[model samples]
Target chain A: MNRIAAFSIGAASGVVGTYLTLKEREDLKVEPKVFKYGRPDSPVSFHSYSAHSLAYDRARKIPLWVIERLSPHDIKKEITADRHRSNFQPDPFVSPHYSSANTDYFNSGWSRGHMAAAGNYKHDQKCMDDTFYLTNILPQDLDNNIDYWYRLENYCRQLVKKGYSLTVISGPLFLPEERDGKKIISHQVIGDNNVSVPTHLFKILLAEREDEEPPLLGSFIIPNKPVSDCPLRTFQVPLETIEKHSGSHFLQNLQRNKALDLCDKDGCKTISLNELTLYRYAQKLEQATSKEALEKLWAEMESKAIKLDKHITAIYKKKMNEF
Target chain B: MNRIAAFSIGAASGVVGTYLTLKEREDLKVEPKVFKYGRPDSPVSFHSYSAHSLAYDRARKIPLWVIERLSPHDIKKEITADRHRSNFQPDPFVSPHYSSANTDYFNSGWSRGHMAAAGNYKHDQKCMDDTFYLTNILPQDLDNNIDYWYRLENYCRQLVKKGYSLTVISGPLFLPEERDGKKIISHQVIGDNNVSVPTHLFKILLAEREDEEPPLLGSFIIPNKPVSDCPLRTFQVPLETIEKHSGSHFLQNLQRNKALDLCDKDGCKTISLNELTLYRYAQKLEQATSKEALEKLWAEMESKAIKLDKHITAIYKKKMNEF
Candidate 1:
């Protein structure tokens, strides 16, 4: 692989591009178009494209994990409208892999869910279209897809708005269940080719900075079913658990000790919905367009943020002590 | 949750039964009938009964994992013959869990294969019958069920015959597949309720001895597809991989380190069928009953065992050195 010379476009500090490192290329079974920040020779930092950063399982025709990096520029990208419904198609790049066809989802109760969410790539039409590749989607429960999982996706983007460069890996899992006395794969399947419904969906978030400190990791494993608007922390698990389930390790190329070990044990949080009232408020703040509306949203946001911050701080403190 | 008194029957040294420990009882979302060996107050060891040792997922009426232990005496019991084919029924215990019915497999083109092998418990009618529960079954590839997976099950029992007490945990996994460039659950479903077919099945074995050394762990994650009669080591994966995919931890209750870390890296075994020819010989010897037949089987077994012994010893020695 040749190293392409660094080029800047539009802004002085632009979205940099990098391909998979030699080590990652050797480790991955399928080739992916991985785009990262800085020059081809620079130390690996945050990534922007997830078209090929996935670990593909050829027998199953699904990725074990999909990774994407987001920054403030990504969250503010507004050049394109959401045309995911119209533009959904098979990815032209991954041939012979035999990804699921669009017709396979017809009449199936599950909604076509995104793994590398489209909203995170709305800045470039090409990037947004890339997210529509069938390789980036999983069969998700309708209620969980639109209401809960989507909210979690937005929250990840919000963190980017708060200036944190993050690397996110999201995927599906088929956990075992006991029937008579033995554990077996027991879940619903849709269509003739057998599009399996995921028992659970997991997302792992890592905060990376230029500093020497270890990255702070937050991992979650949520059931792919209707769930209440409880605090997101309810589903947090350890990075080790997510790594084990996906059969691929994350941030392995960046060797550093874990700064915190979260949800390594039982008794994860399950707080009341009242604690997440600010989350609902944040949704409304996003829609405020006029000057009057902006002023009113800011007033409401300030009041709710104070209350929610204290509540969330207490919850995080207790979880920290538990860890 | 009450502690029932231990009971013994038939032999002077009885098969001791212990239910799910209080710790497992608390961690499990649904109750299972777990039976452990040794005194009620002692730490959990090799489990004999899996009725409650299962980790059940209510969304999908299936267990995450099942554990069982066997002895030579336990294997020799011939009180009952295999009645699994005719005695299948829905588990009455996992109500609201809504396990699949027999009709689901009627025309699905897949076999209702048991996660827990019935032959292992054939000596006792109740135990053998328990293996027929629909919860203990999964939709498996017909050829794989009858040939590949079944052979692996017998091999575990063969290990028991060699005087090694083992804690065996077997479960199913739903791996992700990409369709149209999107990672989705891709597998076949059967019947009206869409009982899903698993992409793979995993079995983890921990050989425990009454010695100071750590237990030997053997893990296999086999695809739910047609397989050849090759060395079983071809499918070996790290125990950590199984735990991650199943979302449940084994041997967590038992505080000990692994005797050997197997398959944690690349270069896992993919030996030829010639090395495993003794396995076929053993299967033939199992069918021998008459004096002439036993003599003929013994003669053939001696020849094959000698060759297999050298081949296996060399493979094991290489593996041990690498570990």
Candidate 2:
């Protein structure tokens, strides 16, 4: 038994020894890097809505500094439209009948609705109208949007009674074009129950108060309906689309101008020159470019559009023909 | 004003019309598939440890259907091994240490060390140790590993008593690597904090359990010290050495396998097969592959041979080197 033991020990050591010897002659290596998890610099972008839709894209663009600077009055302003436009269009870019104006007509029969009731903007119409931005909107059930949404609004009101005010945004999650090919729509769901809503109707909410509550917000809702067939009404445009439309790649540009700043603030590792160039071009488009150059840029953007119109038409035609 | 309203309506319709026309032209496309979150097909592995320096790993490569039909005791026996023999290696593999093995050690030290205390063997020990098959070990603090780790162990034990035996895996947390750009280690931390450990140290007890309560079978201790300069211990093998010892393109093989897995899982969304393959190959070389692999897999697996040798070397080096 002892001899067997010796042999086993020798064999084990020998195997290790052989490995070590080979490693010494050549080299064996292992490299592992540490990764940190926190809030991602960029959240996943949604693509069922339009680039011009305020509900889908508003909160992301609002700089943290800007949000910090905002006062109750500023929040109030977002809920209401500007006094100059009394008879404003529900949605500026698409017609009411096209499904963009009201998302209730789509397959999901849901719309991006605000938990922080748009009606709350009665105190300031400008703020309420600004809430119309695609970013604030979320896919929501019409009944739930009007009812439970109102309940949430009431909850916010109760908070205000206890000396709290909120600047909230909510929307439905939309499946990106990438996901559509799989025949499954990527909708947003909250909590363990997986309460889901149409991908187009996703929303985010941001609320703050003067008291000592640890930021009473961070939630999303998914309504259970298609709501409309019009792409703009039913989907939130992808961030890439907005970048293309604005002619400015925000992440790339931000990194270039402030490499160190980006690292310290956002934990970004590096920035590429392509991003810098895009940023510069965006600046030119915003302030320095000629109309012709801007037109050319828009034309370029047009080519890259994901073309939701085709998807809607195909589905509509199929449905009509089937009926 | 009415004309503007009409124009707005017309503009909206035109936008919808254009979208429909674009859809008819097959411009918008849906993605082909959606990604699922959990692994549905992978087999479970188990790990076990004794009061002494014995650890065992056992996993069957048999299909899941066959394995699931076996009795728990039969499954346990299939993976068990006597720890005293040098060649008593367990197939699959087990973590070399028990959660409580180093608790006494930590109590004497300044810092507390933490480890994955539960959710190992498909939430079973046997499963966890099989997972320990060289691929899962990371450099960790002894104090934290033992002290906090013991606490976590106790918590899991309590949960098991309460009929909550489900195992959960958490933290692919990224920790900083050595100053040299060699490797990064991902650490997994487990166990909930609802249960507390009894301590007879300097601090006084705040509460006591009622006599009717079940004796607290599991309790943990926190380490005295929390941080250190070189918190993690490396196996100390160079990358080049592994390739030479294994006589195989070890790193390349690992990378290829990992890349394939990633492609299958993530839909080729983030990492390419080529990149993953390259990364894996690099990792095999960094850890002294031949010696470590042989020691872990074949010899000293069920016995103290490797550890005794290590102890002898430490003593001899201390005396001889000093002389």
Q: Among these predicted structures, which one has the highest TM-score? A: 1
What does candidate 1's lDDT look like per residue over A1-323, in tens digits? 11112111101111112322223212223211111110011000111132224433322334446667776656776656466443766543333223456776877778888888887777766666767766577778898886778777877776677566777778887665555544454456555445556788888776545543565567899899998877778888776555434433455444336554323321223333443455555555455455566556557656654465664444434443443
- Candidate 1 deviant stretches above 4 angstroms: A1-52, A77-79, A84-86, A210-212, A261-323, B1-323
lDDT of 1: 0.54
* Two-chain DockQ for each candidate model: 0.02, 0.03
Model 2: per-residue Cα lDDT over B1-323, one tens digit each? 00111111012112113232222222224321110111011012222221001111111111010001111222233434322221112122212221112222233322221233222233234434332322122223555444333333333333333333212121111112333432222122211110111111110000112322222111112222332222111111232222111111112212222222211221212222333333333333334235545334333323533222354334333443443
Question: What does the TM-score come to for chain B in model 1?
Answer: 0.64
Write model 1 residue lDDT over B77-106, tens digit each, in one string.
665765734487765433311346788788
- At residue A238, give the lDDT of candidate 1: 70
- Quality of candidate 1 docking, DockQ: 0.02
Model 2 regions more than 4 Å off: A1-108, A133-135, A165-169, A173-323, B1-323
